[model samples]
Target: MITLQLAWRNLWRHRRRTWLTASAIAFATTLLVFMITLQLGAYDMMIDTSLRVFTGQLQVQRQGYHAKPQMRATVPDAQALAARLRAASGLDGVAARAQGFALASSVSRSYGVPVIGVEPEFEARVSTLPHLIKQGRYLSSDQAQEAVLGAALARNLKLQIGDELTLLGSGKDGSIAATIVPVVGIFESGNPELDRHLVQLPLKTFQEVFTMGDDAHAIVVSGPSHEAIPQTQATVAAQLAPGSGLVVLDWEQLIPGLRQLIQADMVQNWITYIALILIVTLSIMNTFLMSVLERTREFGIMLALGSSPWRIGVIVLLESVYLTLLGLGIGLLLGGGIAVYLHYEGFTFPGMAEIYAQFGLPGVIHPKLSFAGFTLGPAVIFVFTVLAALYPALRIRKLQPVEAIHAV
Candidate 1:
């Protein structure tokens, strides 16, 4: 306790210098916490949006359908398979969809588009599409001749709600299929490709138009949260027969591109963290070394009065501990305050939605202020600060009393 008191007094004796060093550590900690929190938050949003936009947590597709995605390569009796999957344990929702590419034409313009047919009520439970309606209304199960267009698609085609558009595509049986449907909704998917080239129609109408009978290209399944995905996938896999020709895939398998992007972000964040530790280590070393040099004569006096060299060294380390603790306190308070504000208010980057959309990320980013981010930065600072004090403390032990006292 006496040694601690001496160390504490020593730290405050040079209040301006001590505080300045503390401030540098504090600023670095704040930046580390904020940047890491933002990266984590952005990753969370990307995973969620990518999953909810279309893929869900898992999907049941015909063996080659995902790779080829042709009308002929579909799950036979898809409605029955969907029903069986829906009754499985740990699954939250199941939506069967028949998807294809078609050319959409209006009186004044034409554009090639990707089209998907879904059962409105079932799809609503599995996808975010129903909630993304920008103009007009979402599709209804009873509306067989109605379709929804992506916002950009509608604009390019010069179509609007209640406007008629003609679609032309190849049917499942190798026959030409054509139909005209009224636009019921326009949605902004926050994905550039989807918003520019996707369309939605009623599942029954899609099957009829494509001459697919009761087949669907994919059945998307979801759980209440990400934690339930593995269990839900295992249950679905076990339910399938040996020769079913159906395969279940998790989000990571379905969206490898987005997964790879997150991995890259993690690597970059780690590099930044290592750099922060190096910077803090150097700063603490410089400050504590200067203090040791300036107090050499005092240390010499203590040595001459029979103070132990080890005890004097310990006091130097304690001073560093004090600085580190003070800096951690200040940094956490500041970083946590900003994190909370970002968590609630969110940060919007205008004109970046399209750029982020290319990678399937959302424009608005909301940082999550969790315990991990709150503690990690300060913990690293504390460790490096102690390490930084070691050299100065050892120097105190090697000091010769006569030489140190007579030094200028």
Candidate 2:
């Protein structure tokens, strides 16, 4: 207790130096927390958008479909698989899809498009297609020979809801066939690849038109929670394929680019954090060194009055710890307040909203906080303080009483 009191008094004796060192640590901690929060928020947004807009949490496909996704490559027991998936505890919903390439034409323009056949109700529950319907109505379960065109595709072909459009493509036999499917609705997915080439039809109609019978290109499964995806996928895979012949793809596997983006964001966050911590460490070290040099006479006087070298070292370490704790308390309050504010209100980048909209991403970014991050700030600062005092502690150990007393 006496050592702690003496340390506190010594720290205040050089108030400017102590404040500068503490402020350095505080600023670094704040910056580190803010940067990590922003990166995590962006990464979460990207993953959520990609999963909800493009792929569900998990997908089940035919054994060889991923390598070659032609009309012929399909899972024969897709309905059974979907049924089992629906019964699974961790799964939210399941939907089957069939995809093929065809040429679509109005009187004014013609373009090659990818046709996706989906069950209206199940697809709506699994993906964002229902919400993306910008015009008319989503495909009805009873609607036959009806098609939904992407907004960009509609613009290119000069099509509107209720317009008749001719589709030219090879049916099941690779024999060219032409069918006129009425445009039922227009959609905007904010993904150019999907918006420009995707056309939607009823699963049964697509099967009849494309000659697919009791087979599907893929089965998409949504999980009750994002973290439950892997566990649900394992359960679904086991039910769908008793053997190792089939491949189950999670959202991360389906979108390699998105996975890479998340990884890069994490790496950048760590690098930024390490750099800031190093800066704080250096500042604390410099402050400790200067304090020791200025207090040589005082330290020698204490030692001559019977204070041991061990006590002197303990005093320096205690002073560092006290200053670090004070700084960390301030930094945590600032960082925690910032994180909570951004998590609720969110941060918006004005002009970039449209770009994010085009990619089916949310305009606002909300940060999520982890308990480790909130508590780690002070713990790390305490460690740096100890390390910074090492040089000063060693210098005090070597100080000769006469030399130190006469130096100042």
Candidate 3:
């Protein structure tokens, strides 16, 4: 208790210097928390948007379908697999879809586009397409020879609600056939590639047109939560027959490009965080060394009065702990205040917004807070402080009392 009091007093003896060091640590902590929160939040948003817009938590496809996605490479037991996946625990919904490239044309214009055939109710349970309709209405479950066009595709073809468009493509026998489909709706996803290429129609319509009844290119499954994806995938995989010749892929594997991008960002953030910690550590070490040099005579006097080297070391460590704790407290308050403000208002980058919009990313970014941010920031600061004090404490043990006392 006595040693603690002495240490506390020593920390406050030079209030300005101690406060400066503490403020530096606090500022570092605040920046780290804010930056990391923003990075993680952006990553989370990207994954969520991608999942909602296209891929679900997991997908099951024929063994070689992913490598060469074509109308012919569809799962033969798609209906049975979808039923098994839908029945699995931790799964929210499962839907089967067939995808292919086709030429869509009006009398005035013609363009090649990607077509997706889906079961309306099952698709609504798994994806956000139902909510993304911008004009007219989504395709009804009973609607036959109906199609939905993306905004860009509609504009290019000069199409509107109730317009009849001719879709020409090769059927299962590789013979070219054409069907007239009434456009039911137009959707805009803010993704140029998707918006310009995608068109949706009823699964039955596709089956009749492509001559592939009860077959699908893939079965998309949504889990109750992201954390449950792996477990749900396992359950669904186990339900499949031994020779079904299907492969189940998780979101990360299905979207390797997006996963790689997130990983790269995380790596960059870690490097920046390490650099900041090193800078702060160096600054604190220099300050502690200077303090020990200035207080040599005082330390010698205390030693002469029966203060042990161990007590001197404890005092230095205690001083570091006190400053670190104070800094951490201030840092958490400041960082929390900023994060709360940003979480509500969001941050917008003007010119960058358009660039990101082209890639289907939102203009505004929200900050996120987690238990790790609240706890780990202070813990790291405290560890850095203790480490910085080690050299100065060792210097105190090497001092001879008489020489140290008389030198200055």
- Using alpha carbons, what is the TM-score of model 1? 0.76
The TM-score values for the models, in the order shown, are 0.76, 0.81, 0.80
> What is the lDDT of every predicted structure here?
0.85, 0.79, 0.81
| Candidate with the larger TM-score of 1 and 2 | 2
Q: What's the CA error at residue 95 for candidate 2, in Å?
A: 0.9
lDDT minimum window of 10 residues, candidate 1 = 355-364
Model 1, which residues run further than 4 Å from truth? 1-16, 63-68, 89-92, 107-109, 235-245, 260-282, 297-318, 337-366, 390-406
- Backbone clash pairs in model 2 (N, Cα, C under 3 Å; residues 3+ apart or in different chains), count: 1
Model 3 scores a C-alpha lDDT of 0.81
Clashes of each: 0, 1, 0
**lDDT of candidate 2 at residue 261, scale 0 to 100:** 78
lDDT of 3 at 179: 82
lDDT of 1 by residue, 1-408 (tens): 868999999999888988999998889888878877877788878788778887788888888777777777788888788888888754547989999878899999988888898989888878887788889998888347999988899999999999998999888898987899999999987777888998998988998988889888888997556667788888888878889888998888888998899999888888878797788889889999999999999999988988888999999999999999888888888888888899898877778767766444666788867777788778878888999999999998889999888767
Which stretches of candidate 3 lie above 4 Å from their native place? 1-9, 90-92, 173-177, 267-279, 299-318, 333-371, 379-387, 390-403
All-Cα superposition RMSD per candidate: 4.7, 3.8, 4.1
lDDT of 2 at 30: 72
Number of the candidate with higher lDDT, 2 or 3: 3
Error of 1 at 207 (Å): 2.0
